[model samples]
Target: MNKKLSPAALTIATVVIGTLGLASVPAAATRPGRAAAVHVAAHFDLASGQTPENGVLEPDGSLDVTFSVARQVARVDPDGGTHILATMPLPADGGANTPILHFAPTMGIVRADDGTLYFLYATGTADLTGVWRLRPRQTPERIAALPADGLPNGMALDRRTGKLYIADSVLGTVWTVPVTGGTPTAWTSAPELAYSAIAGANGLKIHNNALWVSDTDDGTILRIPLLPGNRPGQLQVRATGLTSVDDFTFTGRGDEILAALNHPNTIVRIRPDGHRTTVLNAADGLQNPTSIEVRGTTVYVLNAAYVTAEDPNVLVAGLRDLR
Candidate 1:
């Protein structure tokens, strides 16, 4: 933890976790090829931290990153602003006593295409749900089971065919594990399932080979067709009247799918022929917008707000959409 922000912990985290600001638009108030008026840099760093789990570009974009602090994972220092290098602990994997590192954390801070840095954890605390791997430090590797009620949201690892797409969100199911290292297979979303399926299945990206899913209670954004014994059974419902499809990114230019449309705060871009665009609305200044990370033109939104004592949603990363 980066510590040093005590104003009573910054007024109990700005009156109980609330940090949402980023509605830039003034590179000169646009006009020329349009894309400027979006001004975002007004001080709300709130110590710069929260549940942002996936943002990379260390190859040399100068920085440009974003990640969860833990309980999933966190990292983002991509130059421009938001600086939070690293903070990890907890995540012993299905063995339990999690101590609580990265539970239900899909794509929990990835970097695998062989560059290897894939660290995901799943241990719903007790019942039994584990999928762990932390190689940079060398002592945490448990990839298996992970079905204690299963709420593991969005995980991806198809570096062409390494296969590891998990998104069980309370059983709507979509599991696949085959880093070539053993067993851990369960992919069910077939015949019929996913009707107001509750549980909150955030996001999962696997473009091309197709695996994109987001069913935060059917706000829609699904597509499953990953063969090999198959069974991820037919779920093709791409984009609907989304009002709660929080977190999605391909805006890296693979073409279309920007989605970070939480509640009212927006950031939808979806395309691939279906075409849809909003860029950013909620009048521009997002509030509950949680988790989003695009590198190119810069789009990092994580407007958070959750407060509860004995264990609640607990996400406190305000916003920062610089697009």
Candidate 2:
């Protein structure tokens, strides 16, 4: 489940943000043989106070982002023009004293080849929390509901099978929901999938015919083989000792992975042989980055900037050929 800050904690956070400002380390000097080049594609103005969490790349080169605080989705074009795509509904049970900040429609989003969008969001009520589908020129439709305590965070799609995989940080479980709106079933359950102190089983992807998941609280990445019927086999640890791994994407090389280490404010490249390298760090101007998407040779990152609550930006970089 998402951790709620106490009044005292919120006050402390505000104090810290006020004191530190939004200072970030400068990008490292480029080297002749480096495998990647990092730079900010767009900087979100703090005046807007948009706290974006996750995003997916559209075929037209625009990026669709989810704003957790604003409870809306917007499309950021290649040139940084943001157009609102949809505004999520407010929770039905929002009471007079309820903090609107606590309602996060969904932290995870995915797009199908047909341009349909799917997300996992919560409305602070059992009836409003679940997987939802949003097609162009249509209203958002609820596809499936999670358990009362389930908080959906990361998602993965099996394109070939039209099955969507949802990761619930609160319950530490993954569910398989049909793309066409049907019942969702538990696809896997293990100690590794359960939340520890904070979050677990975040950021999922279908790569090389297997399921790759990030165990955020445990600081590890796990791989589960996909069987003939889209069933998951035993879980295997792929990488470990990561720092607050949230969402990740496969690089051009099928064996390598790029992940957002949220707490450390860095992006890491996990090699096929299990070694890891910091591709981009705070010096590259990343702040609480939550999701990563690589389209062609361009890599896009969503910086949530949750700590300082300032300058939340979408960063872009170029990936050197890994082949």
Candidate 3:
């Protein structure tokens, strides 16, 4: 479940934002935030704890997340404590467990207007499959599924058209699927996972009339316009200095984009005008953040520590304490 700020906490946050606003009366300030400490509300797949994957911050501040433990998916609070939702048991001998266990725990998640949650999880273990939906506040039911080929790793939903943009890691393609549950059509293909290839197609979000994706293998932020006609056209590289850019998000006014890179384990802020600045290091902001979701002034990141046997995801928050 998502954590709700108490009335007192909300009041305090508002005051903090007000104070920060005073120092920003300047013309155009483009600096990443200071090294702020993030509170870890949930720890998934911790050695001794539960396993979780993609997560979303409910509009009301509750958590709607996924836990890929076996063929079943689990939903819990930010603290990984309360059980808010869960999926029906997976079919017996559904498929190979090795691949599914190796590649995906769960790749991405996007919420719909009616509070429905959509996600991309492993088909057996290694397959990067299609989109699946669960009605909000109810036990998860299979609404739809995408292709199991090419390893579909990242996903984003356009609220305007109800279309989903999916990035495939192996085949180097990004496709779009209709929310009404139909066949997904290809959008674009690339050459180099870095300069053009679509390696590690990890995270994605739709904002500012484009679909933003994190290509970790190539360490770049890719964006394609979302004009009319539902076709993804004109791909552009937004940011390029990071070693391994994973998940990213847009700030308020859709002015700034935030990204977390691997290797050095850092977070960077990319200005709308194409400027780059450091936000935080591994010590301060995150470990290995995989995806991000935003709701107004708050930014929620899933710092998925993927090395150890247990896959733990840390939630780093940035609350716009605007005065």
In the range 1-323, model 3's lDDT, one tens digit per residue, is 22343332233234323432421111211235533535556655443223334567766676665544322345545455646464434333443332313323355677788888877655543223467777755655444455554556667888877888877666677778877776778777655332233245667778778877777667778777876777666788877766657677777756578776643446677887778776555545354455566676666666544322223455555645321
Q: TM-score for all predictions?
A: 0.30, 0.86, 0.74
Q: Global CA lDDT of candidate 2, please?
A: 0.75
Give the clashing residue pairs of candidate 2, or none.
1-170, 105-121
lDDT of 2 by residue, 1-323 (tens): 12344332243245334443534333333435532466677776443435567798898999888775566677899998888777777666541122222444456888999888888775556676788888976777888887756667888889989999988776788899889977889999768977765577888898987988998878888999989987888899999988778898988787699989876778889997789988787767776788999988888989876664445788888877322
Candidate 1, residue 287: Cα displacement in angstroms equals: 8.6
Off by over 4 Å in 2: 1-36, 45-49, 95-101, 321-323
Lowest lDDT block of 10, candidate 1: 307-316
Best by TM-score: 2
Please report how far candidate 2 places residue 5 from its true position, in Å. Answer: 13
Count the clashes in each prediction.
27, 2, 21
Each candidate: RMSD: 17.4, 5.4, 11.3
List candidate 3 stretches off by more than 4 Å. 1-37, 48-52, 68-84, 87-104, 124-128, 192-198, 308-313, 319-323
| Candidate 3 TM-score versus the reference | 0.74
